[model samples]
Target: MEKKQLFRNSVFILFFLCAAFTVSAQVRVSDFRYIDNIEGYWTMKTKLGLYAEKWKRVDDHTWKGRTMRLQNGDSSKVDDMRLFLEGDGIYFTIAAVRDSVGEPIRFKLRVLKAVGFVAENLQSPYPQKITYRWKDTKHMDAHFEGKDGRVSREIIIQYTRQ
Candidate 1:
C-alpha cells in the first residue's frame, strides 16, 4: 500500500538523521594538542596536594589523561580521566576514588568567561557546592571551602605542556 511505503520511507529518513547527529556530536580527540602544542606528561605540586601525570591527545578534541600523587606514587587509571574541548573551550574531568573515605571523587576543570579557567569541585564534600576560580594555562590559583564556612585549602598549581 502507498501508506505503508510512505511510513517506511519516513522511518528510514529519521534513522539516517539520527545517525548523522550522533556522529557530529562525537568530537575527535587529537585536536586538543593543536591548541598549545601541549603533549606528553607533566606534574605540579599544589597546596591541596601533589599531582603528576601525562595528558596525550588521542584524537580530535579528546585526550587520554592520568594523574598520580607524589606521596605514594600510585598511578591513576587512564580510563578514568578524559580531556576534551566543548564548544570554544577545553575541559577535563578526573574521576578518582578517595582513599580516606572510599567514595568516588571527581575533579572538573572548565574554562570560564574569557581567557579564564576554573578548577571546580576538585575534592568536594558536596556534589554541587565546590571551589571555583579563574586561571591561566600555566598557573592556577583557587580556593576550596567546606560547608562549615571554613577554608578547606588553597591551591596554586603550575602546569607545563609536555
Candidate 2:
C-alpha cells in the first residue's frame, strides 16, 4: 500500500511539472537569427588600421561578441556587444569593453535582408548606425555612420575570415 501511494504521488508531481512547462513554453525566446550566419572570428582592415570582431552563440536566441582595434602587436577593446530577440526581431546593446558603468546604448535590428543587418541607436547627437554587409562567404564590410550638429562621419572597414 505504501509503495502504491508513493508511485501515485510521483506521477502527480510529474504531471504538474509538465503542465507548468507547457504554460511557460507559450512565451517566446530571443530571435537572433542572422547571428548564427556570422558566427566566426572576423577581422577588418582599413586605411586607418585593423580591427577584430568575434561572435559566439550564448543560447538559442542570444549571441555575444566583442570588438577591438588592433595595432602593432597590441589590441584594445572597441565595445562589448550583445544581440537577442525579444518579440518580433533582434535587438542590440553595446557597452564599454572594460567597464559597463553607464547605461548601454540600445538598438534594434529593424532592417534584416538577405545581404546583411543594420542596427541603429537614435539619440540627440544624431543616430549612430552600424551595418554589416556581406560580400560573400569570406568577405564583408562593416560600416559605422553618424552625424552630430553639422559634422557627418562614416567609417567602412573591410572584413575577411581570420
Candidate 3:
C-alpha cells in the first residue's frame, strides 16, 4: 500500500511539472505584436514568381496589408488583408483586392511573439496555418501550411524588409 501511494505521488509531481513548463513556454497576448513590427514594403523572389507585400499600421491593434504579384517591375494586387490584435488573441482578415471588398474572413491567432507569430483558419482551404518567423535581423519568412484530408501543402516566402 505504501509503495502504491509513493508511485501515485511521483506521477502527480511529474504531471504538475510538465504542465507548468508548457504554460511557461507558450506565447502570450503581450507578445502579439509580431505583425505590427513588420509594417513596411517587402518583396520575395521564388521559383514560382516574384511577390510583393506591403504592410501599413492602421492602429495600435490593427494593420492593413496587401500582397501582389510583380512582373516587369509592375505590381498586380492579389489579396487585401488585415491583422488585428484584440481580446486574448489576434486575427487575420481578408476582404478584397480588385473590385469590391466583401465580408472579411478572420483567422484567429494561435501563436504569438514580438517578432514571430502564427494564425490559423480551420475553415480555409488553402492556408490553414499562417506563420511568420524571422530568419535573421533583415530576413523574415511567411509560411503557409494546410492539409486537406490526406493532401498537405506548404509555402514559405522569405521577405526582405525595405
Candidate 4:
C-alpha cells in the first residue's frame, strides 16, 4: 500500500511540473500591442521614387499590409506583407508582388518594445535584419541591414504617416 501511494505522488508531481512548464512557455497575442501603431498608411520619398505602405489589422493576432510605388499620380503594388502570431513567437513576412515563384521570407521577432521591434532572418542573403522604430506619433524609421560578401550594407528610410 505504501509503495502504491509513493508512485501516485510521483505521478502527480510530474504532471504538475509539465502543466506549469507549458503555461510558462505559452505566449499571448495581446502582449505585442506596440505593433498596433503600424496600422494606417505611411509614405516616404526617395530620389528614385515615392513609396508607400498601408497596414490593416486583420484581427488581434494578425496584420496585413502592402507596399506601393507611386508615380505620375498612380500607385502600383510592389510587395505584400504580413505580421502574425504563431506558436510561441510573432513573425513578419514579405514578398515581392512580381515574384510568383519565390516564397515569402519569414523574419522572426527578436526584440519588441513600446518604441519598436526588430526582426531577423538569418537565411536571407540580403537585408537579413529589419528594424522599425517609432520616432513620434506621425513619424517612423525603418532600417534594413545585411552583409553583402565582406561589406556591410544598410538602407534607412524615414516615413511619415499619411
Task: Please report the candidate that would top lDDT against the real structure.
Answer: 4
**Model 3 regions lying over 4 Å from their true place:** 1-27, 47-49, 96-102
What's the alpha carbon RMSD for model 4? 9.6
Estimated TM-score for each candidate: 0.40, 0.68, 0.73, 0.75
Worst 10 residues of 2 by lDDT: 23-32
- Over 30-69, each residue of candidate 2 has an lDDT whose tens digit, in order, gives 3345456677888977555688888899988788889889
Residues 61-138 of candidate 4: C-alpha lDDT, one tens digit per residue? 899988899987878898788989988788888774112457777788877777888888877767789898998889
Write one digit per residue (lDDT tens) for candidate 1, span 19-118: 8787444433333444343345555765645566565667776777565665555544433556566665455554653435674454444323333334
Candidate 3 lDDT, tens digit per residue, 1-162? Answer: 999999999999999999878754565666655666677888888776789788899888888889999877676888888888778767877664121334666677766776677777787766678888876667888888888667999988889987
Q: Model 2, 130: alpha-carbon shift in Å?
A: 1.9
RMSD in angstroms between candidate 1 and the native structure over all alpha carbons: 12.6
Please give the CA lDDT of all the candidate structures.
0.50, 0.73, 0.77, 0.82
Which scores higher on lDDT, 1 or 3? 3
**Model 1 whole-model lDDT (C-alpha atoms):** 0.50
lDDT of 2: 0.73
lDDT of model 2 at residue 92? 71
Q: lDDT, candidate 4, residue 159?
A: 91
Off by over 4 Å in 1: 1-37, 44-51, 70-80, 85-90, 97-116, 119-151, 159-162
The number of the candidate with the highest TM-score is: 4
Q: Is candidate 1 or candidate 4 better by lDDT?
A: 4
